[model samples]
Target: MKSKGKVYLVGAGPGDPGLITVKGRECIETADVVIYDYLASPALLKYAAPTAELIYVGKKGGDHTLPQDGINALIVEKAGGGRIVTRLKGGDPFIFGRGGEEAEVLAAAGIPFEIVPGVTSAIAAPAYAGIPLTHRDFTSTLAFITGHEDPTKADTGIHWASLAKGIGTLVFFMGVKNLPHITRNLMDNGMAPDTPVGLVRWGTTTRQESVFGTLENIVERVRAAGLKAPSIIVVGKVVTLRDTLKWFENRPLLGKRIVVTRAREQASDLVKRLTDMGADCLECPTIRVAPPEDWRPLDAAIENLAAYDWIVFTSVNGVKFFFRRLFETGHDVRALHRLQTACIGPVTAETLMGFGLKTDILPENYRAESVVDAFRGQSVAGRRILLPRAKEARPVLPVELTRMGATVDEVTTYQTVQVRDNAEMLVGELADGAIDMITFTSSSTVQNFKALLPEGEPLERLLNGVTVASIGPITSDTARELGFTVDVTAESYTIPGLCDAILAHYQRL
Candidate 1:
């Protein structure tokens, strides 16, 4: 007999990636193979190691991508081979995720297994929409039921009438198709016709949408609103609280589409923060940074470093790349014994400090204007200032320093080129209306977006209805120049501020 492996049936939590439990993340990280369902958020896959094999065993109503028997066999086969297997499911695996059936199969095969619980949509859906399952003033109990069942069975075995009268709150999953039947049953079973009910679709995600109406008219209202499946149906007075406690949708940048022009490597944090506030982020890299085309200029700059009075780093990228070159040439920050270092922002200053170099000057505000202002009124006659930055970088620093009577030697430490093909796949997404918004963090992103967009009136028509979000005045000007209206701009020049601006716009509507 082969040595059996351990299997973990892990819950991925309701739609929100942050809601995923720590233990579930641990299991996914260590698992050799992860079999996941379609409903699970793709973000959760990031927790798995790159070497781990991922298998999709998602099933829809009557359509099975991988049959239950096949999935069961796969799990058992992998476990029997002594590989650590993780069965990742959306929400609580045990709660209608068919985790019990898989557990039984694992047990019958004598495979060791453990279950990691998650925040089930049964509770999280309502929570994200501010609908509590139970309220002390309204009700003390809650019931979770499925809206889908086998029609061939003798009966669902649920006492609808008893539940309608006895339960304070009733939450149903997969109930969109049977909304009419469920509403009628509840009404006939002594539930009030005017009882509040809400259908939350794509809960806890930026795409989340909520429809509210009484039991008497919810079916009609949802139909009129074109609400789709993968929704949670809540029947209770708690549904009324959404109007007052709607904090998620109140973020500054909620529902606005902003385009981030930063490189892929640097855009994750900014994009995540913007998306969390309900803003749809579009990533269009206006500038692609690459190593300098020739090392002569960089080598010469390093060798004559002591002749310069000041070394100004315009970006964190320049700081990083320059230091890497310095190390390659077998010289450290100590070699710059007489050069004063000036950084544009706290982030740049911190990066310089990481290399054991203290910044001599850092501005309170993080902009080119601020950096130039910090050195204003200081005598710069005959002083040599070294500026190592991107090839296409703005000439504000060099021009302004020259005006200040300083001899500036500008070196292209890196090249920032336009990305032409990044939007190839996104064209289909844009045409299909899957892209709800496009956010612009900088003027360059707006320019690059227009360059990448497909030609003609189709691009304009596509962007017409899509909300345009800007990070600041400069980005807004670029967006307006592209013939698109700016929908929202952050009060502060930070990603979180941009998000808050988006949310504020949506909440006002």
Candidate 2:
């Protein structure tokens, strides 16, 4: 007999993907079917298994992809099919997310279910806007009320008089549209017209916007700002604390949409750093790293490791692929016991160290020229050296080393092929002026990204106003040669340095 399936009502948390709880992520990872809402960060969808059937039941203002009743039935059907289902909702599922109704339906259907609580936007939005719901000196009472209650009901479920006189802090979800009604009811119930009010839209995310005023003028302020729904409204003296406690809004790269052109496998660190600094990163990997088609060259070189006196690694990919192939070929780090290694960058050196080998020479600058300069001090006359790196890598290192009387056997450990799957979408985004900046981490990324662009439009016109950032002078030169006007180039050729350069570029603006 087939086992019974379970439905997990998971809270996806407010905007930030990092805010998701461990259990919530686990549920998403293990689910066979995932139903997600509009407010749930699309970034969180990365947690879902690739084979999982993803369904978007996002409801915006009055536009819902699927009605509540239909969603309820869909989850039941998926669960009854013996598939593990995860209903991913934004914020706390139980707090005004209609999750209670869904749970009731699940219970009625006799389906086993679990509730994974998320960080509700009610508190999270106010906090991100620097407004604490309750401060000991300000007030101890807090109440969460729905801003968009049922319109068919004859009267509001909220007791205006009790809220005005009893509560110290009031947070209303989905209240931007009902701002006037909310303010009028509070004041009519004897609440002060001058009570502090704050509205946070797209809170806890890079697009967060905050508007502040008093109950008397807040509606006008929101109107002037043209703020729309999906906003949280805060009413209390605690709203005044925002002026000093504001942090998320002040991030240097906040709201900047940056495109990362590094390989997806290597782009995570850069993406995390940029996201942490408040940039919305789009991982449009221009190239993907793969093993060389013919491993005979690397294998041949590895088989006679004792013949080489030195080994040089160009990048982290080179080090990783070389070691991976080395291990696969039944040889360990001990095979290189006699060879002294030279690495181009600190990251490559660190990766090499992970394989129980420390680089003898680490260049001050992370480039081919720097590697050549580092080797100038060593005795290289008649020395045999092994070079394992990308197939499309520059010939500068081998040429320079050969000039120094060193016999360098260059072998391809990895190949970086152009990725075209997201090319059309990227071109559309670029044409629509949705991208703020595009970052190139290597010469290949610049080359492949240029190749991904369509031919009819002038390259300059297509990328007009889009700031171009490069990891180093080489990559910048590649971009410039391809008709791109480079705006930011990292002083240091590293991911963190690239992020810092992007931040500094915005700071100057």
- Compared with the true structure, what per-residue lDDT tens digits does model 2 show for residues 1-509? 66669999999999888889999999999999999999999988888899999999999989989999999999999999899999999999999999999999999998999999999999898888888899999999999999987645788899999999999999999987788889998999999999999999999998888999999999999999998878999999999999999999988888899999999999999999998988888899999999999999999998999999999999999999999999999999999999999999899999999998999999999999999999999999899999999999999999999999999999999999999989999999999999999999999999999899987789878988899999999999988998889999999999988988998999899
- Model 1, 1-509: lDDT tens per residue? 66899999999998788899989999999999999987888778888999999999887666789998899999999989999999999999999988999999999989999999989998988888888888887899899898885434777667998889999999998989889988988998999999999999888877778899999999999999999888999999888888887777666655455556677767887888777667666666666778988978988999889899999997788999999898899898887889888998677788898998899888866667777898885667789999998876778888988988899999989876678766875666677676666777667767777887777755576665677778777678778977878888876665666667766777797
TM-score of each: 0.85, 0.98
Top-TM-score structure, candidate number: 2
Model 1, C-alpha of 14: deviation from truth (Å): 0.7
lDDT of 1 at 1: 66
Report the error of model 1 at residue 401, Å. Answer: 3.3
Highest lDDT: give the candidate number.
Answer: 2
Inter-residue clash pairs, candidate 2: none
